[model samples]
Target: MSKQAVALTLTDLNADTPCCPPIAQRRIPAESAAVLAPAFKALGDPVRLQLMSMIASAPDGEICVCDLTPAFELSGPTISHHLKTLRDAGLVDSDRRGTWVYYRARPTIMRQLAALLTVEAT
Candidate 1:
């Protein structure tokens, strides 16, 4: 990926139109691939994938780090590291509240990802 590709962001993709069609429909553009790669990489990990699902499905549309940690056998810092990766990938957003950090999925990026994976029925 070129440095130029690195500059593309999830927000750079239009909400009404995805940067590219479903990967099954055709090849993903270099720019779109670059923009989406980080998110795909972040979710490539089982732990992070699970974390994302939990955060995305939370009843309040957000979840606390405290609540997340108890579901896994890993150490707190390990979970925090995974959460940081998701945030860095723009897949999630975080807010510090007292001792716990709250996390919520970024719906725009989530939609972009979902669109890319969507395969229309033939």
Candidate 2:
């Protein structure tokens, strides 16, 4: 048996770009799935999922690492690791300000993920 390797290219998950009509509306392409699976995988963890919600729901559209760290019992490094996972998955972005780092949700990817899971009532 021969195995064929698929070349993976980064797919822009920008909010302005329409990723797909809808998961229910049409079939998702394999390439698109390859690009998007990582995001879902990143959120598979309970800690990461809660972190995403916090960042997304932050009043100022961003939250400081200090604010985020205290919310969980985990240590600073554990929280930072989760934040890094989110950043790597393109679900969030962080900026360093003074002595603190702030994280903000990427609306484009959030919208895309929401749309993918949206199911119209029949």
Candidate 3:
């Protein structure tokens, strides 16, 4: 391939203008580490991680709180609190349909997290 064509992919990948270089290449910047740290922090708890997976892998992209509560041995309020934490972190969305509240993973942030963690060898 031509030199110009060869450079295009690198340019396109760096187009986002990330503060840190790629994860495989260099240490992630403290600034970026700060921004994404919460996401990882939010997932640190086992209950929260399972909640995320349940929401992300749910059929129809959503699951009811009614269903989520029973799956865990915790109280309704505890599960609700965890769900709220995920919602506040911009990881999930909740909507009340009649009597029950349903939650779904936010795909935009999911994609961004996936892209950020993606390691493309130079």
Output the number of the TM-score-best candidate: 1
Q: What TM-score, computed on C-alpha atoms, does each candidate reach?
A: 0.87, 0.86, 0.75
> Candidate 3: deviation at residue 93, Å?
0.6
List model 2 lDDT by residue over 1-122, tens digit each: 12121322234577466677778888987767877788899999999999999999999999999999999999999999999999988999999999999999988888888888888898
| Residue 109 C-alpha lDDT in model 3 | 61
Query: Which tens-of-lDDT digit does each residue in 1-122 have in candidate 3?
Result: 22353343233223445424546667765555655666667787999999999999999999999989999999999999999888866679899999989999977666555667778767
State the weakest 10-residue window (summed lDDT) of model 3.
Answer: 5-14
> For residues 4-122, could you state the per-residue lDDT of candidate 1 as single tens digits?
55446744543556767899999877777768888899999999999999999999999999999999999999999999999999889999989888999988888888888999887
User: Candidate 3 at 100: error in angstroms?
Assistant: 1.0
User: What TM-score would candidate 2 get against the native?
Assistant: 0.86
User: Which parts of model 3 are misplaced by more than 4 Å?
Assistant: 1-21, 120-122
Could you tell me how far off, in angstroms, the CA of residue 93 lies in candidate 1 after the best superposition? 0.2
Clashing pairs in 3: none
Q: Please provide the root mean square deviation of candidate 3 (C-alpha atoms, Å).
A: 8.8
Q: How many clashes (backbone N, Cα, C below 3 Å) per candidate?
A: 0, 0, 0
By the lDDT metric, which is better: model 1 or model 3?
1
